[model samples]
Target: MSMIQTNDFDHVNLIEKVIENNYMTYFNYDEFTNKLEFENSISSANWNIIQNNLLINITDSENIENIIDKLIDHLIKLHDEFGYGFAGVKQIIEQNIQYINQPLLNNILDWLIKNQISSKYIFFHGFLYFNGII
Candidate 1:
């Protein structure tokens, strides 16, 4: 019996697998310069918009694009609210949502999770570095 099994790999899935298998990209932010460093060319406005959108969608969206579309909403939020904070960040990862501190948001995510939004869609922060093919 062969332990290894091969499967077809789609383009985006390949990218995801690469990101999942590799080391996480550490983003650098220059507060004085309003600059963020990562592999993607995400700007400040786009980043905020993306973060806001992520917060908006991660709760209820099931589509991969819709979910990934709004990834990493709290990188800046986390950075702003808690600079270099690991406990809060770890909580977000553990629960797959930002607003664990907020009861209303927590309830919303709880409802969404009960409805079947898998962490596969809701919990990916790796898009921070992945420059998706436009």
Candidate 2:
């Protein structure tokens, strides 16, 4: 009986593991324009690294891409009348736009452009333009 059983490294399993590991990590925002803060054991830097790595991996894995898409949509749906729930997520996305796939980023940008007039996301437009992502 070998204590260590070797199995093929599975990308789908990795994706699912990552998602499940972070599922309970919630968002917290004290102020806009600041880096996203999470109310969990993971530090902001760790979360940023996790997100960056995840987004980078998503470019190669359709499973990750689909899961991330659904996750973003679910986050958006969690927004309240004042749009509190996912603002931090948006901030993180904007700051880490380079890691995101072009099409997904475009969709996010389109949503931002459409809602900029009345939403906090308006603050990100200039940043994106300055960063040349817009």
Candidate 3:
């Protein structure tokens, strides 16, 4: 029998990372753009971590439905509270769900709909949605 570990703290750490990079301290357009670029890099790195973790469970044939459900739930909460720029995060999530046959994909989409959360909330949603993760 395999057991699933609830890594709420890990999720919290991810949220903190998002919050730490999403805000502007000053109003320099160039600086703001640079900061956003940096934040995008960090977000990519975080998504890699999340993807690796999910791959591990997929290899093990462990049920990841709960894990994905919790992740989306946490993300929605973070967005609602902090409005963190979640474009990268949403991209990663959409990709993973499309590439992997996970039951929790439906849960994620459901949560997004119920919360009225859209890819538009994230800065890169326009590009991503045009590419079709709307």
Candidate 4:
């Protein structure tokens, strides 16, 4: 009888593979403005790339919920460390939401609400305040 073979991989390896396979675009913050600008144009290819990459990375992790929780922690840390203005915070949250699952987004929203941070402030006022950044 013939037997099928299987392969085993770790979370880090999975994340690397996911990133390599997807997320064709990369960006860095502008030194002068401290703003994140996409290096590539916004297109279907780019959107699919990013979405697939994030999905794979999160799915491969041991605990997806933990990954999202850690991401929130990092966001809080960034806010504390860099004193990210409301606009910056909003942008970060929006970007994260776009990449993460709905449940994770809901958790983030709930956390922000519990902290007395209004979603409206982050959505509307935040964009208006940082129009120049975009």
Model 2, span 1-134: residue lDDT tens: 76966554443455446558984344343322334333442223222322433232344345533534454543354343224334444554454455667776666667666766643355555545654547
TM-score of each: 0.25, 0.30, 0.28, 0.32
RMSD of 3: 17.5
lDDT of 3 by residue, 68-94 (tens): 444455456535653434654564456
| Candidate 1 ranges with C-alpha deviation above 4 Å | 1-62, 81-84, 97-134
TM-score, candidate 2, is 0.30
- Which residue pairs of candidate 2 clash? none
Candidate 4 least-lDDT 10 residues: 41-50
TM-score of predicted structure 3: 0.28
Clashes of 3: 0
Worst 10 residues of 1 by lDDT: 42-51
Any runs in candidate 2 off by more than 4 Å, and if so which?
1-95
Query: Which 10-residue window in model 3 sums to the lowest lDDT?
Result: 25-34
